[model samples]
Target chain A: MRAAIFRGAFAIQVEQIPDAALLEPTDAVVQITHACICGTDLWPYRGQGPYQPGWQIGHEWMGIVQDIGSEVRTIKRGDRVIASYDFCDGTCEFCLQGLDSACVQGGLWGFGHEGGQAEAIRACFADATLVVVPPEVEGDEALLKAILPLTDVMAAGHHAAVSANVRAGGRVAVIGDGAVGLCATLAARRLGAEQIIVLGHQPQRLALARQFGATDIITSNGDEAVQQALEMTQGGAQAVLECVGAKETIQMAVTLSRPGGTVGFVGAPHGQEVPLGHMFSSNIGLRGGLAPARAYLPELLAEVLAGRLDPSSVLDRTVSLAEVAAGYAAMDQRQAIKVMVRP
Target chain B: MRAAIFRGAFAIQVEQIPDAALLEPTDAVVQITHACICGTDLWPYRGQGPYQPGWQIGHEWMGIVQDIGSEVRTIKRGDRVIASYDFCDGTCEFCLQGLDSACVQGGLWGFGHEGGQAEAIRACFADATLVVVPPEVEGDEALLKAILPLTDVMAAGHHAAVSANVRAGGRVAVIGDGAVGLCATLAARRLGAEQIIVLGHQPQRLALARQFGATDIITSNGDEAVQQALEMTQGGAQAVLECVGAKETIQMAVTLSRPGGTVGFVGAPHGQEVPLGHMFSSNIGLRGGLAPARAYLPELLAEVLAGRLDPSSVLDRTVSLAEVAAGYAAMDQRQAIKVMVRP
Candidate 1:
């Protein structure tokens, strides 16, 4: 088997690795059909190395179940399925409470577990970790591409909306024009937000955000951006989805919220500290964290099947497993919004 | 007329002050029949003075309308009414959004405005700041006492519960046993929480909490309290009410919440900062601020009128206008839970 390995800053290598096999009775082996290079992948590549040298990388993936261990119950070999970023024991108390992100036995892909950007990967707790693709959509490439994002970004976007308590006929502001932010815009629309304002620096991404249901865009940054958003919303938005994890962006998201409004933040924190005093005095709320992708993937996949959401456009480039390094470079260099890796 | 003045630490004086008159066209003067010393009042008495020398004090009160300015429409002389701690123009964007605490034209009593612990208070934005008492219950001394807590403590507790999103059959933990925390326990019960845990140190206050519907009480403090609460609730509470605003208590409130749960905090923040990293990782949320008393007063007042809520027990002691200084002393020494002031 072959996998993409994180080989220090600005370096990735596709190399032969031991084949994935059933590591536990509850595990299943999956042959990757499609995987993705996430914006998060660029973090280690940019020298903020949280991963050790030669670490397995990549998380978002869809595949065909190649084999199942004796204890695997809900899924079988040859099933078409998608895996969320984190694998969890579906029966954990937290999982039952709809907080799969907080599952006691859960761990993220590629950090300490099998990386999804490989020819094959072994997944534990198969019954609770994989969402089977409906048979009708299995053979449709475009539909599958649209559904692929549900494994991570799209579900994350939905998490932001849900966290912010976005409602029909309510106003929303999404900060960031990345894949997650665009998907958040789509999620806000799907959840029936009447007015969506997307604030981002990238013109191209902002355009896509408009297509995703953003009613307005603020191209400005910092104080100017906050001022514009506050004025446009007549104070601020009822719900603000924070898709960028930087401290400034987090503060901006908080600033963009109306009194009694909520900021649903799915951005992975990077020196981000919540301004409690400001939020407290203004009656603003903060919610959302790492998306419970496994918990939300099924519903979002249903939406894709029903033809209400298509996020395939987020993947602007595709590569083979061997070219995964180039895919990472393209994303880091802003040459691609998101890169799909096919094996 | 006599008003309580903050003369500095451990000192309060009932001095003859200018009679409260219509300070604005939107103002209404209410002769104070009842006023109360809040736990917050003891902050300055203990030397954490946000108020300067001679600042008029106290904020919770209900009385007959003494007079109304030309612009005061909804209230007039002789009408019975209760004023929220803060005066807000109800027509502001924030006020209309049910965040009266964030109203653009709002200010708290006793800070820069006319204090309630006076013979009369000239409430600005009269139509918005005061809730008229129902004629039938207006003259009932016991019922009025029950309703008076609604002006501040009870409404604040309800705000905490509502902010925490306490739902029917949900499990809750209240992290205080003061007037506000006891009121919060009552609010949780009113909201239909099936399992309510009150964590406090004082046995008497805990007993009061039980009467207000606390199913369990943890008399321990610090780590032991957190451990007991976690074990008792089989993890943690779905909604944690933080009525004490110290740094440690705030952290404890966050620690006590179940994953994906919320901490509704109404404590006046005193050097408190949110633990954002822990909260984000656990999908925990923090909400609530200064209670939007004006917004919740009517609903809670109705609850009182319906014989559903009685927070009068929170007012364990009372004092006359001249003895307001003694009331402050008793509260500072924890000799009284709350003190009612009469002029």
Candidate 2:
């Protein structure tokens, strides 16, 4: 099997690797049909996060089940399914509370298990880890490409909206114009936020944001952007989505929220100190952490099948499995928002 | 008039001072019938928070409105009322969203205005700052003292429950065994939390917590308390109320919560760094800052009048205004949960 590997910092390659097989009765093997490179992958790609040579490198995926262990009850062979980047049993206390990301028995893919950016991969807890691709989206290549982002990106955006309690007729400010940020704008719109403001300095990203449903865009960075957001919303937005988990972005998110509004941050935290005094004295509420993307996949998938969502726009570039290394380079260079991988 | 002054660290005095008088048309002078020393007041008492010599200290109050400026509308002279520690313009965007503590026109007391532990207090935005004491409890001294904590402690507990979204049938862990923690146990009961766990050390405070509706008590401290709470809940609590602002308390609050659970912290943040990585990976939602007691005043006032609540039990010691300094000492030494002063 051909698999994408993280060779080292700024180094990636496609190589012949051992084929994936069932290690547990609950496991199922899938032939990767589509996969996507996420912004988070860049952390290790740039050596900001720890990585070992030859680490399997992608998590977002959709594929056809090639085989299933005898114990797998829900998923069967030959069925198409969208994979959850984080594996969960769906019945643990955390998953029962809709927090699938923190599943006690399941962990992130590409860490211990083989990554999705490969010819085939073993999915642990297959009965709970895989959701069948809606029949409406079957055989639709464009839909398949679009729905692939749901495994992480779109579901994350939807999580941001839900976490912030974004209500109809309410205003929200989405910080960071990455794929997650753009998806947040769309998700806020889908959740009925009347005024969606996307804050970022990148013109191209901001433009794509507008197309996704942002009612306004602010092309400024830091404090100035927060001030503009506050002014635009007449004080501050009811919900501020901090999609970039940096110290500055977190602070800006707090500033962009109204006194009683909520700042729901979905980005991976960078150990930023949330301004305790600011959040407390202002009576502002801060929520959201890692999104339970698996919890949101079904709903986001329905939206995609119904044509209310088409997030494939975030897939600005595509590459064959052998060319995934180049795909990573394009994303790192800001030449593309996200890159789709065909296996 | 006599007013309590924060002379220096561990020093408080009730000294003869000029009488409080209306400075604005929206101001009203209240003859304080009751006031209490709060846990947060200890911050400066311990020389932790910023303070000034002879700064007017107290912030909780309930009294008869002796005078009202011409523009005061909702409240009038001779009405018995409960004063919010924080003054606010009811019409401001923040106050409109029930965040009166962050009123655009108001900050906290003791900055420029007279503190509540005085014979008289000039309350700005009288109509918005005071809630009329129901006629039925106008002459009830015990009831008034019981309601005094509502201005800060009890209201804060309620804020924790609401902020953490403690729903009916949910289990909650209230960290801290202070007046606020006891009130939080009471609040979780009021909000319909089924199993209320109180984490603290003092047997007296824990006993009071049970009286206030705590179903379980863990006297152990630190990581042990969290593990015990986790065991009692069979996993982790749905809501965690952090009433102690210490760094370690915040960490415990997160540890006590289940994934997707919320930790509502109402303590004056000692600027403790929230463990973003722990909170993020656990999918734990953190919310709560300052409590807008004024927002919860009306409902709580009704509860008090209806005899559904009697928090005066937290007022373990009583002292005349002349001995107010001793009242501060009692709380500072942990000899009393809270001390009430009659001026």
The number of the candidate with the highest TM-score is 2
State the C-alpha lDDT per candidate: 0.90, 0.86
The per-residue C-alpha lDDT of model 1 at residue B328 equals: 88
DockQ of each: 0.55, 0.66
- Deviation in Å, model 2, residue B22 alpha carbon: 4.3
TM of each candidate vs. truth: 0.93, 0.93
| Residue pairs with backbone atoms closer than 3 Å in model 2 (clashes) | A280-B289
Interface root-mean-square deviation (Å) of every model: 2.0, 1.6
What fraction of the correct interface contacts does each predicted structure contain? 0.57, 0.74
Return the lDDT, model 1, position B306.
Answer: 94
State the lDDT of candidate 2 residue by residue for B1-343, as single tens digits: 9998888888888888988998999999999988888887888888876788878988988888999999988887789888777888899877888888888887667754689888989898888888998667767778777788888889988898898889999999999899988888888998899999998889999999989999999988888888899999988998999998888888888888887788998887876388887777776877887888899999998888788978889999999899998888899889999999888
For candidate 1, write residues B1-343 as lDDT tens digits.
8889988988888899888887789989999999999998888888885788889988899898989999988997898999898889999878987889898989889986789999998888999998899688755889989989988999999999999999999999999999999999999999999999998888888888989999999989899999999998888898999998878888888888888899999987666356767677889898998899998988998889999999999999989999998898888888889999888
Candidate 1 — which residues are off by over 4 angstroms?
Answer: A7-11, A23-26, A46-55, A69-76, B7-11, B22-26, B44-55, B68-77, B136-140, B219-221
Error of 1 at A123 (Å): 2.9
Cα RMSD for predicted model 2: 2.5
